[model samples]
Target: MSVSAYKRVQRDLESPRSVERRIFNRITADLETWGAAYDRAESKADRLSALKGSLQLALVDNTRLWSLLRRDLSQPENALPPELRAAIISISYTVDRITADLMSGAGTVAALVGINRPFIDGLAGISGAEG
Candidate 1:
């Protein structure tokens, strides 16, 4: 997200809001941050030996975020439809597997981004646009 956009979200968050909207904003912003970090890491890692520390940080953060999401989704009163929650849980597993692969240098950051892009769009109410 642009600085202006980030600022706007911050402003929006300062006021009263629904719990669902707050969660949505936080997740979307974090994804944007992770996406930018991954993009930067990919560019910096062209030499294979020059990987950025930001990549590791982003990966760890991504895992933590998914863990939180999974825990929340598992709750009986999460409010999301069952099918959508289940699908997200399934994708979280894929993210877990891919995160391990990427840690071992056998996966691309792009894969992680591809998985997240759709969720980001969906959270923003933009359906089915290519990541």
Candidate 2:
């Protein structure tokens, strides 16, 4: 690809709020689907499966986004919103922390889903149990 096209992709990726919003939307949809599935669940594994699916999507979306941020931070920059900058820094720290934890074998994939663990837990509770 041309430099301009690549830079355009980087610019899109650099928008922390946009990336975060997309991730949040994915998680929200997952939660909604999981909730519905839970209420209509035919088995405990069915509910757990929905939750697991949610977790998988949450991990996929956030990790891809954070990877983009890691790449974007190394590039040239224009003015960014203060809140967005802070969010990016926080996200960078979080990604680094999670990576370190994984490398150290101190965490599992279940522990690295997203920032809304409490929300997920609550959803799980509503489903019946943690399973």
Candidate 3:
């Protein structure tokens, strides 16, 4: 490969901004995939049965991601403002609560997916996702 391309690759590997973008992109993709799965399951004969298993798995993964994000934001050197950190941590708690509700048959994946939309947009720097 050319030297310029190689240097870009090296920067992508080492730069925290790029790393954060990748993480956000990955999370967004996962949410989209899970949403699609739910949609498909709805068309099946045993949607509740299918959804229970996969939904639990997906919610568990989402909670784990939120847990990690909360841990990071709670750190002393996170660079974000205190208010923003608190807000994000608060959102994580809401996610946890909503996840519990969904697992208990009292909520829908739509709630979890909706709450996480801003994280995808804010983290990926997308001002308008609909366009």
Candidate 4:
């Protein structure tokens, strides 16, 4: 392809929506892997270790996703309502608490899984709506 054409392709791949979708998909996949690892662990130590690592990965990815959403919401041209933006911010705070709790061994695998389900659903809805 021509240079311009190649640049266009790159731009399309890096578009905000495309980036968001990729992040969302990755988060979903990571959560699934974490769930499986948590479920298959055979001993208490193994289970705790698995859960800890899984929670760390999920928390990092979740943080990245929310940071992007916050950036978008902060843009002057963003069309999403103020309430929606506020809700997203609120959820980010909750994620922080959840991450801290999980890291401190005060949270459960089931709670992490429960928290991720709604995000997965929301991502799916966005994908469906865009498609």
Candidate 5:
């Protein structure tokens, strides 16, 4: 391949959109795995164990992802509209609340599943990955 083509490929690989899509894909996979674990848990102890391990970790990772997105959106060069940034901030707040509730044993698997669906859908929409 030409040097210019190779350079273009390298740049595309490192672009912010590519990075964001990769992050989103990872988060989606984690959520799916956690969801399956939650589905298979047959007892409260089992469910709680899953929640404490994979589910909690997924939530933390997701929160961190959103935090990074919010930070990026706050930069002057970010082209996303102000309303989109505000929406991200609001979702971040919800994620924090959900994480706190889960940690405190005040959350259910159903609640967590409910919270995850919208995020998964949104990620799928943005990444066009059917996640």
Candidate 6:
């Protein structure tokens, strides 16, 4: 992925499917695990709570985002970083690529999900903020 193509790839993801579904599933699963882990962190309770709300928001966002991606992924080719920050960018990039491929309009499941170009861009922007 070249820098110029990054946006194109991101654009593609907006259309739907490809690798987005798999990636979204992974993200959802990871968030669930993370939430549970946070819950279990007795020693770090204070720290976790302090940041847990943000973490939970991110988790919810991941769930909503994953829902969109999965609908697309089921169609065809479909797809993280940071202590949490790196994780966000990494996930965004992977999903962007997968979504871009789906945007090419080659798969059948594309219509199932309603990921638009703005959504992908928003994800990128959100990820950048975290990064």
Please, what are the lDDT tens digits per residue for candidate 5 over residues 3-102? Answer: 9999788877785655666676677577677856655767656666777677778878877887787688778887878898888778777777876765
RMSD (CA, Å), each prediction: 6.4, 11.7, 4.5, 4.8, 5.4, 17.1
Instruction: Name the weakest run of 10 consecutive residues (lDDT summed) in model 2.
Output: 119-128
The per-model lDDT (C-alpha) reads 0.67, 0.54, 0.71, 0.67, 0.68, 0.45
Give the winner by TM-score: 3 or 5. Answer: 3
Q: lDDT value for candidate 4?
A: 0.67
Report the number of backbone clashes for model 6: 20
Please, what are the lDDT tens digits per residue for candidate 1 over residues 60-129?
7678777888998999999989999999999989999987866655556677767766665665567785
What does candidate 4's lDDT look like per residue over 97-128, in tens digits?
A: 86666555455555655655666656456443
- Sliding window of 10 residues with minimal summed lDDT for model 1: 43-52
Clashes of each: 0, 0, 0, 0, 0, 20
Residue 18, model 5, lDDT: 55
Per-residue accuracy of model 2 over 59-78 as CA lDDT, tens digit each: 45556656665566545573
Query: What alpha-carbon RMSD in Å does predicted model 6 have with respect to the real structure?
Result: 17.1
Best by lDDT: 3
CA lDDT, candidate 5, residue 17: 58
Q: Which 10-residue window of candidate 6 scores lowest in summed lDDT?
A: 105-114
Give the per-residue lDDT of model 3 (tens digit) for 1-131.
Answer: 99999988887676665565566556556656665555455444444454565556677778888898899999999999999999999999999998776555455667777877667666656676452
Which whole-number lDDT from 0 to 100 does residue 91 have in model 2? 67
User: Residue by residue across 16-113, what tens digits does model 6's lDDT show?
Assistant: 44344445555555444444544444444443453345445544455467455445444434331214444444555555564333234222122212
TM-score of 5: 0.63
- Model 6, position 13, has a per-residue lDDT of 69
In terms of TM-score, the best-performing candidate is: 3
Model 6 residue 76 lDDT score: 34
